[model samples]
Target: MAKLLARAGVASRREVERMIAEGRVALDGVVLDTPATILQSLNGVTVDGEPVAAPAAARLFLYHKPPGLLVTERDPGGRKTIYDQLPDDLPRLVPVGRLDLNTEGLLLMTTDGELKRQLELPATGVERAYRARAYGPITQEQLEELIHGVEIEGIRYGSINANLERRTGANVWIEMILTEGKNREVRRVLEYLGLKVSRLIRTRYGPFLLGDLAVGEIGEVKQHDVVSFRKDPTRKGGGEAPKLVEKPRPQQRGMQQIPSAPKAPIPKPQPARRITKTSANRADKAAFAEPTRQAQPGRDPVVLTKATKVKRFYDAKPKAGTGAGTEPVAPRAIAPGQRPKVFSPELGRNVRAKPGRTATPTEAAERKPAKATPRTAGKARAAPSKPARVKIHKSRTRK
Candidate 1:
């Protein structure tokens, strides 16, 4: 089997093995049992009932990936993948490197698995250029020392080419070109230097620059360039070299011509009219037109006629001892000849006395006892009660 599929051009060799296990890959009507099984060509192998063709010639493309897209074939979380952003007409190509979900910028893609592996190898020494904005002061000395190398969390990274662009307030912008791209290397290194990377954008990968490519856009390298690049083993893959082609510069013209001033038209005079005495008198009369005929004083400013007042009926007051709030009070019904019962608002209704009986004012006043004041221990002891007497006379008679 070709290493192309194993190198991620199609799928990993392990995945191919699984496909074989699932009877998806057939060799002359026989399902392959193991990945160790080798083949000279795709001759008798078919996947999903479709014949596998020989790998196409190697091609490379520059892709501008926007943030929030993953560089994976399939995400278990159903995230949008780079394959989804690629054009439908694109041939099978794998990302030369990965950009984290939050990182966006230039990404290299290649159709040839061998070419992809060749470019991505650390031995290739391909330079990837990135612009990073960090939140902290980074002196030129520190930047220069970065080229010497920096150790982050016990991991040693090779020297990097770093240049300070500018510093505004607390943030500093830096342009970095690196040969080796470790996971979050730029961010981790800057953080070790007491700086936090606020934004990171990959502007170039090897000889290919992003160059105004809108996010999610892809552009292919000329076929001749691809062949030339492959032939030259010394070619640095990223944005380190440019072909000798004289780019035309825009031509400058002289200052714009001033426009001519427009001519102003002359005003014409009208004939004068003679004023008669009557006309003068008419003008004076019009100037003093009789003061607007004073509106005759209207019927004495309308006296609001008193409207027939409607009688408002209110609920009867609750009995005396009952609560004086809005809560309903039960009413007491008595026989016609019985004296009206005294109202007790606190009791929530009228209280009726028995026939031929009436509660005196003293009895009514004494119905409830007055609250007693707290007393001292000595005062409490002074109060005493009468004692009971024994009946000895009945016991003597019985004896």
Candidate 2:
């Protein structure tokens, strides 16, 4: 009966057993007293007065649980739980393992209670990895001793593979991998080592990682991957753990106690070689040193380098018009006593320049007739003059 309730996604076998002991599990309104009751199916079984639904195909999801959320479905103290953060569309699921209220990272959620038990069982030997940031002095040698396991305050912890990743002052980051995840195991172990854990984050579990999954985001595992992983979870082959990022050592005021890795002496960037006029001349001569080869009738033409093309462009003279094939304008010479003439855009013609002042560009102005004022009221008003008409000359045609 416990197994039936567990497989039906009601809860874990242990929890179901507890529910039966509490008389919450019933068969057609008659509360079942024993978890060992003979039952072929859950047809008439009901838990907490709700009819049990048939279990669906097993499904798995990877949820990046943020801190401050409990793993349980509900909390007695009204604290937020993982279910509150989960999407409403997700099916009834249970966590493979529990994370502390403040611990954050990769959390496996599954629909099958049986599968969850299989994963959470310490005998299955599925590894769980965590990165803990703790304060206190600890050495790699001390952490290495955990491989043989340890007993703290009468509670025994299984063999743990631990390594000191890096340190900052009195604080250090440690990476721990273990199979048996006892309640408050990580914090207790670190506390036994005289280290106060400031932050704890689970990085990997079994074959899943919390890789790049944002806080509170959930992702489903592929059906094929879940199937393959279930075949042989104890195998050392699983998801690759991300490299431990070493925290930058803070700059100290005095000589360092621990010697850091020897840094490669940065070769003083040699002052950039200055291009002298002599070197420029030599380069220009060398560029054209090859005899100019003429293209033969049947041979391929010479390809010009970018530099050569640019040189030719600058050396080319400006043309009078924008046409590509227009003839280049010849340089105009000025007489010794004559001032240079400048183009007056306002006048639409080239005008002689004054030696003292320069021409300032002005906009084209329209000419208006002069108006007679009161002082000139008695005087005859000038007649309005007509605009001058220019004659158009047409080209003569050959007759």
Candidate 3:
């Protein structure tokens, strides 16, 4: 009975059993007591007081779920759900796997609960790819180490092919590909590595991608493609996956059949040609062979070196009062009590006179300024002497 309900797109087998336990599934106005009570057909069977519709052909849809929406049908907290964002004419679809409220990316929706279960099972080894922008210091070597997998908080995550995409100031973008998508696995693994994940986007899942799928938009997979994918989930590299479709006309929503254009013939890939040492030597000789042309009389002969090519520019003429080998100008005479300023070789100009000090033409410029004091602005005040003690008072106290 559970299998029948699951195949009928009512729910998964386990969910059907749970519904029976809750007395929500009834037949002939009598609630079912157990899922074990099997019937050949769903004659008068009803789920939640509604007659179950006949199982139509299995359908698959790629929905670009935006962040901040629950994947469930309804939320007890009255938060928005994925259903609220979907079109009104979409069928009773179920998400293959749950995406967190803050995780935005590709979500597979299917009418057949059995198909959903099959796709969600980890044993299927369908690869899921995600791009995460995290804030922290992470190196390419550290990300590469994730290929061995990491364990955090007693939960052992499977091998992940993680690569450092690029760095943005204090944040880094990481691309990770994994098969086992345990609950919060990506977040947990990244945080354990001392990274704070700011944003995570699932770019690819199995053979499908979230390509060009606008948020809140959905595109259905053709029936033939769905059947082929179910037969072999690991298939790859034959053709491009379906893209996210725009909203159809209200009248043509579910019944419209998109005509596929003829596909161009793909040329068979040629095998790589193996080269022997002799062939490699021949190729090298051919590449390095000198041109047969004789050098022109007035032109410099072209020289080719194994090192990088460098273009030598003509040496620029020295500007006025600059460059080496130039004679130094004599210092001008200084008037009495006035310091003569010295020209700084490093500064390429006359150095400024030191504060409260004089400089000679040959004197080196002061490297630092003297510390300022209260006396710098005015004359220093003399310390006040203590008052003279009275000897008569002391004598009277002694008497």
**TM-score of every model?**
0.56, 0.55, 0.58
Question: Which is the leading candidate under TM-score?
Answer: 3
Between candidates 2 and 3, the one scoring higher on TM-score is 3
Name the runs in model 2 displaced over 4 angstroms.
Answer: 12-33, 43-53, 236-399
- Candidate 1 deviates by what RMSD? 25.7
Candidate 3 residue runs with Cα over 4 Å from true position:
12-15, 22-31, 38-44, 48-51, 237-399
lDDT of 1 by residue, 222-332 (tens): 777777766763565444222221223334688565689998888789788899999999999999997665445674464567888666565555466675765666687
Q: Which residue pairs in candidate 3 have backbone atoms (N, alpha carbon, C) closer than 3 angstroms, thus clashing?
A: none
Provide backbone clash counts, one per model. Answer: 14, 0, 0
Q: What lDDT would each prediction earn against the true structure?
A: 0.76, 0.84, 0.84
Cand. 2 TM to true fold: 0.55
